[model samples]
Target chain A: MKKLILALSTAAILSVASGAAQAATKVCFLYVGSKTDGGWTQAHDIGRQELENHFGDKVETVFLENVPEGPDAERAIERFARSGCELIFTTSFGFMEPTLKVAKKFPDVKFEHATGYKTEENVTSYNSRFYEGRYIQGKIAGMMSEAGVAGYIGSFPIPEVVQGINSFLLGAQSVNPDFAIKVVWVNSWFDAGKEADAAKALIDQGVDIITQHTDSTGPMQVASERGIKAFGQASDMIEAGPKTQLTAIVDTWGAYYIKRTQALMDGTWTTQSTWDGIVDGILQMAPYTNMPDDVKQAAMDTEAKIVSGELKPFTGPITKQDGTEWLKAGEVADDGTLLGLNFYIKGVDDQLPQ
Target chain B: MTLAEAILLTITTAATPLLLAAIGELVVERSGVLNLGVEGMIVMGAVVAFAAAQLTGSAYLGALFGMAAGCLFSLLFAFLTLTLVANQVATGLALTILGLGLSGMIGESFVGQRGVQLEEIAIPVLSSIPLIGNLLFNQDLIFYISIFSVFGVSWFLFKTRLGLQLRAIGDSHGSAHALGISVIKTRYLAVMFGGACAGLAGAQLSLVYTPQWVENMSAGRGWIALALVVFASWRPLRVLAGAYLFGAVTIGQLHAQALGFGIPSQFLSALPYLATIVVLVIISRNRRLTLMNTPASLGQSFVPDR
Candidate 1:
């Protein structure tokens, strides 16, 4: 009688599990840092929540935060695949190789990689054009700085950071040909103390304006304490430096995340590479604050022009670090050159790491 | 402030935490107990300090709480290695892993919150002096404590009777035990002191260093402090010099980049570590000095045989 009852209970549990499985799409995310990092990972996690809010019961979302970007990442991805995750999002540049490695093993599961270039049959690559907003920050820095020197704190000398540096300088040079920038590579993506020290070091060396490509509010807080102008990266960090933040470049991935998950649910998902910018609403500028009225107006004008295709930040007469011409007059930078950008522009004073 | 003055101030700020952590670990090793959990204790201190400060709105109370947390965390190591006689190296490593994971869990809610900055003490006439004024006079409480601790530790190690007993136990725990020195009790106190110092270093990071709490915010500084202890030959004064030298290299690299030096940042960022190794090589060449300073029984599990 006990065996018969146990068999009946097992059957009942299996039926309920199958019924729930048929009704929902299991989506998962692998984050390189903590969800409360207040920067890069937090921005991505916000997008994941938006997907849940949009689909509610039809979609089940789970995420593993602070997953290191190596063999551990591959393990996390494969675990998600084994647990019936129909789609997984690997949201970090270092996770590119790991995502590709796991995608090959789980041919049936779809994978989306943020800020990565590689793609497989099951893997799709997506990145927001953060350089677009960086250009606006450069313009603001150029117009407002008393010293005409902006200090840029970079995480690594990757193409992404290099692209932002070049875009910032080009934007600044357009307004003031003599605008100078000093770049400091902190060598890590998210150490608050190091980032703060880098900012202080820059400020001491006569940089009146501060900006960072690294994930943290350290530089912003330092800027606030020092009473210097700064721009935020990855997320709105005005709370960190309310009085000092000129503006922020916020990464909004909610629409993209929801759309991709919806596509998977509808069986229309396919491997693709997407590098969306301001026009696509992927990169957004926070409300212009802590700046003069005229400067704010100029920033808004530049934003509108970029959105309307009337202006391109990387257009024409650009020079490489070695004084070689990168783009002649009237020529806009192509996606290939921007994606693999390895050299600094002529005005940047620091050397790029090979 | 002049550019030179500003750079010096940054260097001082950078060096103090390393000095604090290294000095604390120096005492632990000098007691013949090598606690590898400096990194763990630091993070625990940082998180607890940040949380306590945020809750109480007093940075001092928060710092004390941080030191308490670190001391309590080290007691686990003391119990495992000193009482239960676990392998010192393995237990210390486990303590670090446990501390890191536990701190992250405890710090989850505290992330993104702005911390209260420790107020600096500006002396009247001293702060007004030119060039060296602000650099020397207008410093935070932790800076004064860190500098004072250096002298205090030096005196305790060389001049105090208890200090001699502690060092004696470190040199030969068995001999000290036969002499009725209570080896376990002395080592336990030494480990707790090390934990408190590591905790204070972490509080410096959260409350004074960046004025915020971020996960893993200690960011390998704990490991560097451990290296500093070895690099300084376990001496308090040498630890001060090594830490400041490291601090100078760190801030100096940024200055190099800001000046637009055409060197790769990877190479520049490696300067502090490279200097540490070079200094270590130089110091190790003097075998007698190193032998005199290093604890003979470091990293050994002490079984009382009672």
Candidate 2:
């Protein structure tokens, strides 16, 4: 009788485990631009593929590309929900509201938004600390640039981009106190011609080193053509400018995507916000090139220190554009201030667009 | 390069594409066809040109392919509006939408791939001259072509008999038809010319401007070219002037920002469009020029009395 009871309990547990394993997790991704955009969207797509590779047949993934941010996004998300997507990842900041709206309607479905702030019971936000990589590029720019002037091509004046600019300047100032940065806001995320034109304009004005927060390889191509140095953003752009690309700040979303997908599969998914940096492997630096060994070593060291929390890009003794002390001496910047960063720090030469 | 020289060179680069597209559209509008699909055609030209250049390893061949693609795309519009009697405005809009979507699909694999840049043609003796040489002789083949197009278009429209017939059709299709001129045939040729020009403009973008493929790389240059046609009052020379003027404003704003003039970047970015509006207002104030230069049957669908 005792052996029969144990056998019955083992059979029940095996059935439950197999049942959970057998149900495939249907995951959907909504992208703001083409998957082959060669930048941000491309990075996310790569991560999605990595997720697929990691999970194999246990997971099924679907995605809709070029979904606009507003009402159309809501429709896309709702369609995914209606199609029985158990979890959806809206991979652009503009889809925050739509993701939340769909999450509310489909309470059982999980939603993840990238580079967003809002969250609910079923909605989670995730972002990588891209500024950390920008900080390292700043250091390299300050050292390598002949004119000590770097140009930054920004897509928008949002906190995210502003944070990167500030961190970059801070990194440059650390290496060269006299280092100056000129910023041009193209007011767009992916205008290749405008970005190239902006790069040329900056170079013409004595900017030798260029960096862009935009989504195209245009600036890097311009840098290569003009014989100037530049850093790539979001993806490794060495192919775009083999001679000019010093290093690239690559966004690695694969691990996070895998983690979240695993959580969903394990039935342990919950609403939470995650802001990870180099330590968590969300932000990665491409192999340093077009620089001396020592310079490359120094960049790698700085990256290591950032990951180890030994160096903070936005330490105090920082002055805002309006001549106000933002952080006290020796005090690192807090998340709140960083999240709402809108003003330029002291060494930047250009005015922040209001 | 001196700041002035740099600025001038930048302006030339900026203006050439607009000049090319505008010159072509000028002819189309002169033939009484309104095609707002220049943007789509330009983008199609850019991707096709990039792909061809990458595959063939020759920039010149890439440019030819680009022009051919544009001509082909414009042929679709001609078939719809001219033969099928579709509404020109709606058909043009549909063409733009279709072109944009189709280019994106076609360009998916070409993205992130760099193409060979069109080499600059430096006329040895002439290019040795100071500012003028660098401005004129030391330019790429496309730049020379764009300038030649200006003179060629001006001569064709004002000096040539075919040009007069095209203008007549634009002014009054009915009068031209009754005068024994084939209105539909002339319009078809003009539209094809415009498409070819728009394609060359796109090729200049991918092969010379940035020398790479990116979705929507043409940005709003097509619209700007369209606006340039209106700002120039449909004249070829004025189109050249307006394009360069807009280019100067564009580069000037960047200079202003780099100089740290304390102006907000947003306003600096807005300067180009603002200048466009101001120039348009100033030019449109002279209503006689606009009316005299304007095509009377512009945008009107000509269903020849069949």
Candidate 3:
């Protein structure tokens, strides 16, 4: 009787384990900022919600926010894996190395990193080509600036921020040749006070328009106070200073997130780098507020051309910071030239920090 | 702002947080207890202050709540270290980890609320005195209170009978106990005082420093305050000087980066921390200095009956 009972218990346990393994999909998200910052993390949270709403009872999602990019991040990732998270998404550039490291430890788990350039068999990368939207904002900024000067509040000296600044300058120069962008490095991602101060200093220097890559609406607040027009950064910040906000580069990660989660549920999850722009609907533009009809029409024309592949934002005749032509007329910029943009355009006032 | 004015303003703002925290830790150490829980207390204070400020739309009330919450949390440490007679250092470290997790968990709701900042309190005649005006008179009320706390504490420690007894407990708990000074009670009071100061420091961070509650907003200021205790050899006035000097390093780094110094911003940030380590190394190398100023019964677990 004892032998029969032991065999029966073992079979029951095995069946239960199999059933658990066959349950609904579990996805985990780790954010570098809070879920309510109305910025990058908030955008991703929206995506997560969209996925959950679409997947309904078939998907299970868990998220940890404000996880710094370091050993702490590694510990969080390991904990998520131990908790049986089958698919994980880490949203930040600094998470690149740690995400890859943890992915190796959990080969069966699929990992996706945002704004990072690392990959493995189970790890893939994705980023929105945000420069495309900045180009459109720059065109409007150039049309409005009386001083022909714009302020660019940058978070860091990374390639991503550099690309945005360069693209904004290029778009401005297309409309106004002598426009100069004054760059101020705040060295922080979400410091509102510093962002506001940087904007004020630029305004003091006769900059009539401001563009910020920092993840806050503080810069726009300062611009509004000073009666200067400004472009919004990540997410719609119209409420911060509706009068001053020109347009925003609305990052639509929800579409991709919903798509990816659906793919994971359907067993079609694959590892590949996905760079989506306006053409693919990942990088979008908010409506132009207080902009003239002609300015709005111009931006719309650029948008249409981009979506239809009739015009490329980074078209040729581009010059390096050292006055050397990187892309001559009628030549398209290659990934190498655009990826390694380490210099200022012709009209930038700030010296590039070494 | 002139160089002198800016330097003065920076010192006061920088010193307020450290000075407040160090004063509290000084009291804790004087009672033969070393509480590494300052970090946790400060973070809690930041979250509590931000929450209160957002609810009431008043920075002052937020600060009060912050201090009260901080003191309440410190009571837990006091109970464990003083009542339970557990190892103070270990308990303190545990309290910090608990406080960090708790603060982060509770601070989730304050991710984007703009805090009400305390306005600068400019004295009628003093604020108009050019360089002196900006330096000494153009600061918020917290700076004034921080400076006064230094002297207030010095008087309490050196002049008052209670202060003498507290020092006696640190110097030789057995004698103090024989003389009828309650070691546990004295240590508890000191620890609570430390908690109050740490709370104020945290309030400064969330209400004034960035005017928003960011996760780990206190950064390592609590640890820095602990180091300032060692750097100052535990004297109240010297603690003040050390706190201001450290603050100078913080401001100097920003100015250095702003001036386009070739050094990376990361290195400049690490400089102040590196300076603290160097100060510790030098003090440690000088054995005489260490033996002269360290509290006799620091980090000691005191059991009255045993």
Whole-model lDDT values for every prediction: 0.92, 0.92, 0.81
Worst ten in a row by lDDT for model 2 chain A: A17-26
Ranking by TM-score: 1, 2, 3
Stronger candidate by lDDT (2 vs 3): 2
Per-residue CA lDDT of model 3 for A79-156, tens digit only, reads 888898988999988888889889989999989999887789999898888988888878888888888888888888
For model 3, the stretches where C-alpha displacement exceeds 4 angstroms are: A1-23, A32-38, A64-86, A94-109, A120-122, A136-156, A171-250, A265-269, A285-313, A336-354, B1-15, B281-286
- Share of the reference A-B contacts seen in candidate 2: 0.71
Fnat for each predicted structure, in order: 0.73, 0.71, 0.09
**Candidate 1 structure quality by residue, lDDT tens digits, B1-306:** 788888999999999889999999999999999999999999999999999999999999999999999999999999999989999889989988898888889998877777899889998999999988899889998898899999999999999999999999999999999999999998999999999999999999999989888888889998999999999898899999999999999999989988888888999999999999999999999999989988999988888776
Best by TM-score: 1
Q: Put down candidate 3 lDDT per residue, B1-306, tens digits, no spaces.
A: 545454455556666888899988987787678999999999999899989999999999998989987899999999998888888889999989888889978988777555678778888898898667767777776677788889999999989999999989988888889899998889889999999889888888777655777666676788989988888777899888888878777666555544445566656557777987888888789898787677899998887764
lDDT per residue (tens digit) for residues A144-234 in model 2: 9889899999898999999999899988888998888888888889998888888998998899999999989999999998899999999
The residue pairs that clash in candidate 3, if any, are: B24-B194
TM-scores (chain A) of the candidates:
0.96, 0.93, 0.93
Measured against the native two-chain assembly using Cα atoms, what DockQ does each of the candidate structures obtain, in the order listed?
A: 0.79, 0.61, 0.17
* Deviation in Å, model 3, residue B153 alpha carbon: 2.1
Candidate 3 falls in which docking quality class?
incorrect
lDDT of 3 at B202: 88
